[model samples]
Target: MNELPSIEQIASCVSGYDPNALPVAQAQEFIARFVTPVAAVESIALRATLGRVLAADVVSPIDVPAHDNSAMDGFALRGADLAAEGDTRLRVVGTGLAGQQFDGAAPARGECVRIMTGAVMPPGLDTVVPQEFTRSDGDVVVIPAGAVRTGDNRRLAGEDLARGEAALTAGRLIRPADLGLAASLGRAELPVRRRLRVAFFSTGDELRSIGEPLDAGCVYDSNRYTIHGMLARLGVDAIDMGVVRDDPAALEAAFRAAADCADAVITSGGVSVGEADYTKQTMAKLGEVAFWRIAMRPGRPMAIGRIHAAGPGSKAAVLFGLPGNPVAVMVTFYAFVRDALLRMAGAAPEPLPMLSARSAEAIRKKPGRTEYQRGRVVRGADGDWHVSLTGAQGSGILRSMSQANGLVVLRHEQGSVAAGERVDVMPFDGLV
Candidate 1:
């Protein structure tokens, strides 16, 4: 519930800054400073909480295991009874299954109990010798010396989660493992943030929808499809507003409708200086928009602002105007929009780790702009991983993005790279 610093205050912190040509890191920081997590919360069934952000911290009401239990199918006995240098023979008094425990008192001295995995530890027993390490003859079991030490294979109560402990904190995006943990804690329901609603559309007279017949000069709108898939991966409630023509009135209507209903409005195309399309003009009419030429390859032109509805008492929606090129749209989305959307959806900020790998070929580059080249990483027989750039690094090359498994990131000051040189890569498929 803390207030975020104003944009002017944030910008004052950056040195040698120029809004005309912003640094990638500085732009990210600007966007991050403007984000405020959503406050709406809802309680739903545990299974349905997957992919939703936790609204409150989940405290364990009881110990995780609730009792001391055996971690393996073995013989449970007092560790002190085992001979230090020789085998110990003892009579097995009872058997313990996962859900059932020995009914009588603890086994007498020189006696042991056969225990299954998850079975509660019998009283006075503090260790278990796995069944593989023991020999059984009728009711007699022989435990080898030093097979297991005290507390070995015996899971103590609350070992995983202690009662009254914070099992999962707020702002966490619930995952499968988290759901299982909640169920283990006897929680049938959970409180999670409401899903963020994102509405997006493509702007271009030459862009056609899937069902429309393609003309000689027009291309099917793949940007909307790509954007839809990417938004789905973020678990947002996506509102797909079909392509809007490059007209001021049509663009204004789309922006207003999107701002009225959704938390964010994302548009691809008409932000670049050359495009000169009416998108910029229409966005200016609706809200305060800034066009920036970021020092980055594939995606340099971007517009960001907050669009307000026409009527009073209406909430404003964040706007992201991305470049029109197929690959550029995706790059900008991943680099900027993804993180902004996550923060807006009530999830805590967690940076994705960049992995290092060797380059398979020399790459051309400039020293000023940052570059994110699509790459296909493979493991060599030498037990090392190397990455080769996709056939084309052009902004328009959609195939390059499709064929790549990761993006080889070159920093702003980095120059051309030599073959077999180490590079940082952000993989596509992994926990984010």
Candidate 2:
């Protein structure tokens, strides 16, 4: 097995890489090297399928509506029977309603049938006159106007979707509209990818769980809840392993349990090189560390590795150790674990959406590192988009995140951007 790389060594290895590259490019490289998707299928009811990836293509088994019908409440008539101006009266032979059909042939010359919306058109009827244009008088109907066009106000069967055609392809995530479509096709269930199981924990003797008595130099454990909420948003089945004190034996036991039961394990606050940080040591004992540091702000101390099987018939579990700071934990997850979880769920790669906006204020940045500044974007009166930062860029302030609707991306080589300069803005709602 290869020895674990030190933080300095990992930085040296990737030092020459471009820092101006988009987040997607950086994430793809990491995903290709460290992520392996599991292949499994499960049957889920249509009501519960939203956000789940489809394991197979969905083909429509039946035609929508299954028959030609009327799109409006009108009088069904043969096109030839339409009279010129000054024509006043026509005979009404029958009526058509939804779920009930007029079995008789279409109306003959100067004859018509009353039809309601969604009612199947009677055989031989090629046109329909709206009820507003006609008057009824005891077995007599009046169509007092110019000629009406043929095939008007009628809906054709299978016009929306053809039978046996692919309605949705594999790897598409199901949405509310998609579920409605499946219901229209009469599907009671769907085949979807099984949810990925994730296990996560927070490490530090200075942290206390919520509802527990506070002690000196102790803060309530927050990373665990933050990770749990983030995973919930991604639709993963996340298990909270609670907080682990800075003890090697306790950490080892937690890792063993997570490796035995979960596809992946995540921890925060113990991967850095502080004197009390035992997580890196334990990780070196258990498996090879793939990478330990990245050339980015707020999330520099991060680790990715795999835990070796403890015994026969056991499989390795991917492990991620993130920085202890709350903001850093979130940024690292969005920059790394989000894509890994998506891949593990059998989802196809999707690039985050980006928009161009003018900066509303001046931005200062160095030339060697990329920065993600929280920003608020709004459409100006001229219909152009503009973005401005949400005040301070401190890595420890979680409040800044709540005020931001998107991220203002600063390139590696760019020094300063003045107001009204075009910049890339990525909306946070869709990405994480």
| Best candidate according to TM-score | 1
For candidate 1, report its TM-score.
0.95
Q: Estimate, for each residue in 99-163, the C-alpha lDDT of model 2 and write its tens digit.
A: 89897665677777888999988887877788887787988887776735778887888987789
TM-score of each: 0.95, 0.81
Error of 2 at 237 (Å): 1.6
Candidate 1 Cα errors over 4 Å, as ranges: 1-9, 311-313, 430-432
Candidate 2 regions off by >4 Å? 1-24, 76-92, 109-112, 126-152, 213-216, 273-276, 309-313, 379-385, 411-415, 430-432
In model 1, the number of clashes is: 0
| Candidate 1 collision pairs | none
Count of clashing residue pairs in every prediction: 0, 0
lDDT of 1 by residue, 359-397 (tens): 999999899888999998888898888899989899999
CA lDDT of each candidate? 0.89, 0.79
